[model samples]
Target: MESTKTAMEAFEKLEKVGEGTYGKVYRARERATGRIIALKKTKLHEDDEGVPPTTLREISILRMLSRDPHVVNNQIEMPLTKSNRLLDVKQGVNKDGKTVLYLVFEYMETDLKKFIRSFRQTGENIQPNVVKCLMYQLCKGVAFCHAHGVLHRDLKPHNLLMDKKTLILKIADLGLARAFTLPIKKYTHEILTLWYRAPEVLLGATHYSTAVDMWSVGCIFAELVTKTALFAGDSELQQLLHIFRLLGTPNEEIWPGVSKLKDWHEYPQWKPKPISTCVPNLDEDGLNLLSQMLEYEPSKRISAKKAMEHPYFDDLDKTHL
Candidate 1:
């Protein structure tokens, strides 16, 4: 690791671009090289642990997965200023003497959320070719992670970074990703955004697999086509109802063992409607792939590797991607 005191002098924060539960993100520039980068500053307390285990897990995972172009690259350095911690995320003290961790990475211009909002604001649909390309890239990146035995339990538009110019998308924010090899462990159902969350997770199934991410991919696919969230829910129950109303209430017949999940309950039933009614603009092949991703039974849901081969993406030129 390089001397972070020198790392501190090498770059300057340009502006705060975003903020999340863990830290603030800045659009920064390396003074010496004139290279722009994104700086994620993770705050720590002197009274607490040296570094959060979640952050360390993310570092380990990113090191393994960043070789894929679709996964965001993480660059490492030593602690800045007066510090005793050994970390790749350069450490320093804030103005108030509070410890902070800075993670440096190549900057992306925008994220999927803002990109979709741009099209929505302009009353224009994201081009079909562009949608396919984005989704294909998403599947490819996701396949890479799953193939490596890691589960990115959370996948949403905000976590997907993109370059406004090339529309190249990269998966980020791996703090929520769990890399434990399975026989799936009982994780908390509390993970993932409600709308993108899998039906099994919403039903209180703790032992989830990679299918949860596929559900989010399906939601993102629809949002890209319609320029609106497929299912936007404010609460846990509301989220389930939104999904149930559209996909129709799930039962043992379609999603066996669903009724036995921890959060299972009696609810009003609705027959499954043709999936096309919602995304009327999506073509047959797109609908087919979306349906497979949104499958109620986790086991029946399509894998990312399988999804990348779907006919919906057959027209894409893979050489560049």
Candidate 2:
């Protein structure tokens, strides 16, 4: 932007709120208007060539999708230069002399992760009506992304922001990173809960589709119903085991090309079991949808659009969302 206003000059930091894939997220207020917003500060390395192309692509995607109510407000970079293809958010450098990028976003009251925690702490299940509403909103948002050819890659509760009063859910950190952004980052170990990872990802598939996010949607669906993670695992191997133990071990018959995956291994075999055994609270329609989302074969997995159309969400009003 041409306005010589940097993020520091335009906003006053209120307090640190949370962290994202790349940096510290702070709750701040605009100095001129006092409107509350969240600032995601990404620290750039001294040796890096420049801003990654993926980051620019993400910025454009955010701008395009933010119009959808279920997606967060766009993370517009401050004081950007218009000439270069790389519209850097590099507002200023820190005391340590590392370059910093500030991502401006509309602040919501809380996120789904914290929301679920509060309910869990109180030993209460989220109301059935509330669960249906949230799930519909989630499916609507995911359907929007997939239609645009964007894969969230990571879709855990933490990345889903929510409003306490309205229960508005927005998908955050879309196309953020593979690793290295979070403080405790490790490839697949830390910074990510092993629970929501898709079976194909665990099997080391070289390619993926929106089916991955649907798998996570299924996991989140179960968590919302039961007030706990469906497949809480400590490690990748254990995560796959958690899935297999519940869904039954996959084979050529269940998931074709299962043995051909890069990380495939010979292991225990089992028969398929009813999904309701694990997520027993769901009604028949709900169970059917969840099972489709958790299909072992990626090809058979339900798409977000189809998920939104499922009988499980028959009573939900779609016009408002």
TM-score on alpha carbons, each prediction: 0.91, 0.86
Candidate 1 residue 303 Cα shift, in angstroms, is 0.4
List pairs with backbone clashes in candidate 1.
none
Q: After superposition, how far is residue 185 of candidate 1 from its true place, in Å?
A: 2.0
Candidate 2: residue 153 lDDT (0-100): 72
Instruction: Give the TM-score (vs. native) of candidate 1.
Output: 0.91
Q: Which residue pairs overlap in candidate 2's backbone?
A: 1-80
The per-prediction tally of clashing pairs is: 0, 1
Residue-by-residue lDDT tens digits, candidate 1, 256-276: 898999989998999988889
